[model samples]
Target chain A: MIAAIRVFGYSLFAIFIGLLFMGIGRKIIARIQLRLGPPFYQAFLDVGKLFARKSITHNFVMDLGMIMSLAGLLSTMLFVPVAGHMAIKTSSNLILIIYLMAIGHLGMAMAAAASGNPNATIGVSRALTMMLGYEIPFFTVMLGLIIFNGTSSLELIAQSQAGGILNWNMVKFPLGFLAAEIALQAIMGEKPFDAMVAPAEIASGPMVELGGKYLGLAFLTHAVSIFVETGIMVNLFMGGASNVFTFVLKQFEIYLITILIEAVFPRFRIEQAVKFLWTVPMSIAVVQLAIILL
Target chain B: MMDSPSYMLSKIAEKDNLTVYELFFGPNHPGMHGNFGYVLEMIGTEIVKVRPNAGHLHRGFEKLMEQKLWVQNIALVPRICVADPDPNEVAYCTAIEKILRVDIPDRAKFLRTITLEMSRLSSFLMGMGALAAAVGLYTAMNIMTADRDLILDLFEWLTGARVYHMFSIPGGVRNDLADGFVERLYKVLDHLEKRLIEYDKLLFENPIIHKRLKGLGYVSKEDAVKYGLTGPNLRASGNPYDVRVDDPYAAYPYLDVRVITQEGGDALTRAIQIRLEFEETINLIRRALKTMPEGEIRLNLGNLSALKVPKGEAYAKVESSKGEFGYYVVSDGGMKPYRVAVRGPSLPAGLLLAQKHLPKMKIDDVAAWMASLAICPPDIDK
Candidate 1:
């Protein structure tokens, strides 16, 4: 029961940190352009507003997609270890996490495509490009970790990283961290990699067509995804923050770096992005592996 | 002689009996803005040919301008190029000013310069923002527009309007700067400088942005000049020509200014040219603020009803942020102009650039290339 409390504490802390960055990202982007932006609680308010909104049904498929999205997120979250242990963990669940993550993304993409809006159609295509580009590096990094640990259990991967922060897997196998870092930013759907949801380009891609309670579900799913993914990254690399405070701080550090990238760069086209992820970072991963073996 | 998208669409029937496809690009497409459309024959993603379709935003300015009083038409013209509207006001007023022979005051000239440069900066921010958005750097684009809102606020404070300023009269400006407006303006400039670094990080140095934008919308200098592309698009093709330098209107003669140009006439070059010119516009605004002389705001328009001019035509052009905007006026010893024809810069570029220049490009790059042309369709249809 004490172990259960720690796991709950970590997930809640991760969610809070993720929500904070989402708000900060919007405000900072506004402030950078000489405007006084939205209030810091804007993200929280937006989510609160989301739940309070009236529910409108478009098609039953939308609910199906919505439920699938939330389920995928919750399933992914369950597999993620908190303090090197999970609320529910299994050895074969790494494969389940991969499917859950991809399906959640696909469900959102399919939902957007089914909405019959032209911009939504374009958004789905962009999402496909992002998924294709990002998943390759993400899985490759996962494979490297799996091989390194000699097991696919996320709990085992988390345990291997712990020996103090300096002896963390990120420090020992810097290339995995480096490669995963690039993929992680893309995975988080941050800017530069956020072409999928480029508001001006396709008017909010994927979720542009979704509205009322439907969009709220998508937003909640995204919030949960961020918490789960950041928690997973911390478990694998940063070694679970030692306490609740440290976990929150580490997740925030990741979020700030993503914001810095967002503040600094324009996005790449799908073709260019594919080339960037597959070649450059994979090469970096190879070099990282060489350093590890040598 | 130009075939419709249907005509070229028909030629596909004879060649291998390929199915003729009619596709619409906008009024709702991801790339289009403020109501635009392109009827094109697209084979997969490659645009075999494109037919330009406009008139969604046809405000009928030629008709509207005739209905409104000469003073009120000042409000009508600026909507031609929403990104840069000051030149619209200037060209129309100057045409009327020419017919009336109103010797605008020295302070009015400087105010015109200030307003024009402010509009230029705001518009440039938007163009760069749209260009970034075209290729999908959304954060950078949002940053630009959200920042552009502040400049619009500044205009609103000065002119009592968010858009359609109607601030410039034929003889002079409507109002002077409110107290501390200049100081606030400087603070905005400082903030803009700092914000540009954030944009630099998110967009300028990012390798993905380069690959997508650069070399994708390549338009040669010959085609650029032939199509009458002006402003940043012309300059991007290595053409150093600017109406500001060539004609030297308003306070342009008093203030020393330089033209910015680039070697490649592509979308990326156009974007870069605009980026560099933004700095120049800021400098011009600062200079106008410093060198502004205290004087009256208007020329002596003692008589409003019996305005007359020599029965000849005078055409005046200004280097608007979008392109070269000109007004042709013919007076017949009357209160209203005999025939007043306003030539907007983006009009021709929209027609020729999309119709002629956009062939062989992928449908995905169409928006980026169109943005590079900076075609304001209302300017054309109006």
Candidate 2:
């Protein structure tokens, strides 16, 4: 019972903070475009309104898929160390965390396919293709970090670099860090690689059929995704913070950099996006791996 | 078994050893610009066939104009093309002027030129913004939209109506330029000059945008002409044909408007061509304002409601923001027109050209391609 409470508390905390970050990101983007944006708590209102509305379902699979998607991300977040703190207090294996997070994407695909929306199907297909593109370089870069530190546990790698700024892997393996940064942008589904969610092209892609509570669940999933991906990046290179406040601050800094790029650049086609990820970031990751292995 | 629902489902699932799926592109969709739909046949993400469905926004302007008097039709014609309405009014009035043999005052011609150029600026801004929005760059869209509002402000000040200004009548414009209108127009132009540079850096010069747009939709010079493409779309294919230059109307005869052309007939070149013309439009507005003569704004046709046009047929064409928008008017010495026909620019481009190009295109390029082509569905349906 105690363990259940602890896990439930952590999940709620992650959801709350993630939603807050999303709201702030929108406000910042709006300010960049010279408009008065929504309130900083607008995400909460959006989620509230979504959950309060009646949701439609095509099949039993859609209901299960929505639950599975949210549950999968929540499970993935459980393994992620937030500011040197883990909710489950188990081995924070980087490889295990990566695979667990993929379940969320698969769950979304299942729900979208179940809803029988072609746009959703196209979105899911593009998303999976983008995943195939970005994951290779991201995994290779993570491998370099793993080989350098002689461990696959995220907590150990983060703890190893916690002494000072210079001790951060971002300084040691600069090429890998650069490659990981680019891969992270794709993972977060920002502008250039965001063809999966291309609103004008595919009617917002995977979320085309999602409405009411299903959309709310999707929003929560996205928030948690931002948390997990940024948590991993912060732990991997930025030297995971000793406290929750500073850790979230580092995540905010990373998200702001992405939004800046998102504001200026246009989207790449799925093929062009994959081609770019393979050519530039892939080469950098491979070079970084060679240096680490040697 | 043949009539069962399960069998029907199975039949839809498989067809001729290949899964053929039908996708609705709009009528009500974010991907489409206006109330337009495309029934697209697809095998996976590759589009196999496209059937363009328009007419959801059909206001029946041509038939409606035949019921109204010649002067009253000024209010009706502007509704034909929403993005650039001035050209519709200019075309309609010019057609009537050709029949009535009324030479508009020189000052009215200059004012009409200014209004047309201003209309083009606002329309190009919308086109650019939509292009950016299609590519998922909402920042550029919002900035361009906000800047476009400044021009609308100038319009509101001049004609008292921002969008559908019944400013152009049968003889000339309804009213002269408002007080300090030229100074305010210059201010808006100065602001646009700075914004255009920022837009170039943010969107046009960005390598990612270049990759997304360049060579995506290729319309060759011969194909562009063959397909009846006009204005920037045709010019992008190295054809220096502009109705403003080829058949000068209004103040264009007095004003030396430079026709800008590009060699590449692709989406990127088309976009670049609009930006180039935006600059030329600003320069033309400035020249027209400077050389504008002071005279009567209208020819004072007695009793606007009961005015009778002579028995004649006249066709007038104006280079709108989209392409050459032509108005054909026939009069049999009656208050109402005997027949009125609008040769909208987007009909061929939207229906014929889209049917030709949309097939074999990746599903992702459909929206961006439409936006870059600037297919105004209202014009097509009108």
DockQ of 1: 0.23
Q: Residues B317-336, candidate 2, lDDT per residue (tens digit)?
A: 99998899998999999999
Lowest lDDT 10-residue stretch of candidate 2 chain B: B1-10
Each model's lDDT comes to 0.74, 0.90
Instruction: Supply fnat for every model shown.
Output: 0.37, 0.75
Error of 1 at B208 (Å): 3.5
**Predictions: Cα RMSD each:** 5.6, 1.8
Lowest summed lDDT across 10 adjacent residues in model 1 chain B is found at B1-10
Candidate 1 lDDT for residue B220: 83
lDDT of 1 at B74: 67
Leading candidate by lDDT: 2
Model 1 residue A130 distance off true place after TM-score fit, in angstroms: 3.3
For each candidate, give the interface RMSD after superposing the true interface residues on Cα: 6.6, 3.0
C-alpha displacement of A180 in model 1, angstroms?
A: 0.4
Model 1: per-residue Cα lDDT over A60-96, one tens digit each: 6667877887766766777776565556445635667
